[model samples]
Target: MFTTFRGGSSGAWRVISMSPVTGETLPAVPSLSVTHAAAIALPLLPSSNAWRLAGVASHVRYVERNEKVALVAVQAGLGRPEASHAALIPIRKNAAWWDLTQNERRRIFEDKSRHIADSLKYLPAIARQLYHCRDLGEPFDFLTWFEFAPEHAAAFEELVAQLRGTEEWSYVEREADLRLVRERV
Candidate 1:
């Protein structure tokens, strides 16, 4: 399956395509445009494969750690000014993620809350530092954290260009609500 999430102030849409084998969703590829085709029809084509390779490359270069609160931090680069950082906090009972009984989901949510509270005394600090680092536009802006990596930013931009060239892109929409906080210390 394929799922596309599109959102912005002007407008937004999402398209989902499904895979027969696993019944899983994958990112949808969009249709290419004429102008884009004219730009890349020449010698610049070969280098495109590099991105595919990069995608398969080991994420080991990235340091990953999970906290009891179901938050995962992926820190890459070593003291480099351009270092990339991303933190994923999976709140239990993500309504958009899956379908489950309310009671069961509530239990999971409570468990996650408890785990988060019990994991570390400094968790509040960590959360504050990360979430409050910058103001991205909306709650869904959290997704932009993954794009902060220089490499990822470039690659994704290229990927979007390529997809636009093929005329395979579609649109979909969703609502995401989140809170932001900063650490005082």
Candidate 2:
């Protein structure tokens, strides 16, 4: 009864998740502090509705791509509550979004959209990672994972609200928000 996303690039990426509906099993499902999953029909990840759950792990920043997100922007939750609460948000851009020039999209994402500036306020409190799933050919373009303590839950919600209300969000044709509460080992 567990789910596992492909982490650690050893050349092969694995897609392992318990099939809740079918009752399939993954014997090697590791002991996870937090996990999020969506048993949805792939190919078409409709925005109006997407089964979502909470999860963990982060690697890089969306803006700087390979560069790491500023230490001030995310708190690893070391020696604290990294598993207290978590969120996995999947977002897919519309066709028109891809049509835009790189510079144009960057302008909207940074300036008019204010996606970065808005999120800066809630940093460290809400640990997050922006996963670009587009290249992987996953349904969503980005899988943004977030973790925070229960005390900062409200702040996390506010941060999401701010980003969702921005102009860049308009390109998000499909979205799935997975909320998760970690179970103690």
Candidate 3:
């Protein structure tokens, strides 16, 4: 069983131990939200690619709740240019995004929603930072849909780098696959 300790403003962390079943008190591992669980587990899996992609999708969805940035999406691709293109969309809006077809939207949702749902486990904490992650229903892409307060970009960047750099780094390519979208709402 999992025991969660509320850390007040710091949120809750879980303490996991098998000893509970054996009527003993063993040291528990640091409690991790579902996102972190997936992040840490992704790289260790035999199918790292699939897991990493799902991890990225999960991370993206976690960060999408920011109110200042409207939407963000990241996609892995066959070439550096493809990654580049995916990265560039949030920096500048594409007319195509606003013109997406229903099929395209459905494809994006089907592919990305599970990660988003997993990400939602941390929504309360993420919401405290004024951000949320989502999938734009576009293929195997992970989307971060959020908004940033004025002058918060630098801080946001730092926070993102630090968060993504943790055990989840493998799930998200810091330099390539994480996309940011910021807009004043």
Candidate 4:
């Protein structure tokens, strides 16, 4: 199993290096509902790209039951990345949080806290990959990945602080932000 986010897991990040990694794709089942998508562990063919790492989620009941966020290339001139220094943050919301109505959650998420707006300020500089891990039986309900150049490191730190300080974070029961670096293969 992979390590937990921030520093919750015993596997705290000390040094980082990425050579080549091999793992199962675990193709999501076509019949699986978005709410149940993550737990589909049924194995599928492995990806050809040895450098690629894959994990999967979504937001909203309607959207989650249907499509996910579209995949797009990292916009150029966004960050001054000298090398691929990355961070993987896995987060899980408390069960009691889900018991609330959708409108109730939205009020706190947007009106009370600006989770999306705060992060948007970073833009193309700090590239991100968001994975919903809830349905997968994983410890976390969401796994968010980030990569940035050394120059924008401070921006990333500020963005993180802005998020964790929000009222929305009160629902977060578990979280870990692990740092990493990619080595040339």
Candidate 5:
């Protein structure tokens, strides 16, 4: 399925904060909307009005059979009632990262960075979904969406910090941290 994230003046999610973690940044939007469809068209945002990002929900990459099994066993689904807090992080890797073969990149991502292993600890607490956009000519390579309850916010921060400190993050050329909260009726 294709998921599209739209940031604008109104949405089901209220944007709380947006800060650049590395290179470029996006204009601040008050809210966000997430949509899913089998076929979707990219919309052109009028400069200061809004922004949209889309990515496909594909098979997990850079993971071994064992790791995949482990994730499936513990990972929680998104949009849980209590998972009101969310983050949308857009990341772009340097050309050097893309030049490496899949195995080589996997080694850095898992063997060196322990991305999957470390993340397992925070499992059901912080549910996450990853979207790939490199092939779509998008400015960012990956868009990761994470959701958690208010009480788990600290844990979420710790998780992000740990991932960023890893060697794998060295390949990231641009990243933005966008935090949001589900709109209450």
Candidate 6:
């Protein structure tokens, strides 16, 4: 299924805050809503809408069979009742990153950066979903959604900080961190 995230005045998620980590920032919006469909017609967004992004929940990439098994063993599902705090971080990497062959990228992602190993410790606590939009010609290459209990917010921060400090992040050209809270019905 394709997932679409809308940032505007309406959504089940209230925007806590949004900040630019690098490059241009997305226009501010009061809330965010997510929807899933077999196919998404994105141009339908109202003219007044601040922004919208869509991507597919594709298979896990950059991991070996053992790593994939390990991830599935420990990674938790999204929307757990007690996990309300969330963040939608959209990132666009520079051409240099895209230029690299898949193998080269994988080496940097894990062997050099240790992205997966470092993140495993925080799993089951911080649920996350990664969406790929580059194929759709979206502004961002990837949209990462993360969820956790309010108390685990600090750990989430640490994860983000650690990832950003990696050599892989040097290829990122644009990134925006949008913090959110699940709106009570």
User: TM-score of every model?
Assistant: 0.21, 0.62, 0.24, 0.60, 0.96, 0.96
- What digit string (tens of lDDT, one per residue) describes model 3 on residues 30-148? 32212333222323333212222221322222233542143232221222221111111111123453366755543443344333333333332232211112232222222232223
- Residue by residue across 29-107, what tens digits does model 2's lDDT show? 2222323355322212332222322222344333653223454445454324454676656677888999998888878
| Per-model C-alpha RMSD | 17.8, 10.4, 18.3, 11.0, 1.6, 1.2
Ranking by lDDT: 6, 5, 2, 4, 3, 1
> lDDT value for candidate 4?
0.52
* Stronger candidate by TM-score (2 vs 3): 2
Model 1 misplacement above 4 A:
1-97, 128-185
Pairs with steric clashes in candidate 2:
36-54
* Ten contiguous residues minimizing lDDT sum, candidate 1: 49-58
Expressed as tens digits, the lDDT of each residue in 45-126 for candidate 6 is 5764688899889999999999999899999999898899999999999999999999999999999999999999999999
Considering every candidate listed, which one attains the maximal lDDT?
6
Provide the overall lDDT of each model, using Cα atoms, as 2-decimal numbers.
0.24, 0.55, 0.28, 0.52, 0.92, 0.93
Residue 40, candidate 6: how far off, in angstroms? 1.6
Instruction: Judging by lDDT, tell me the better candidate of 2 and 4.
Output: 2
Error of 4 at 160 (Å): 0.5
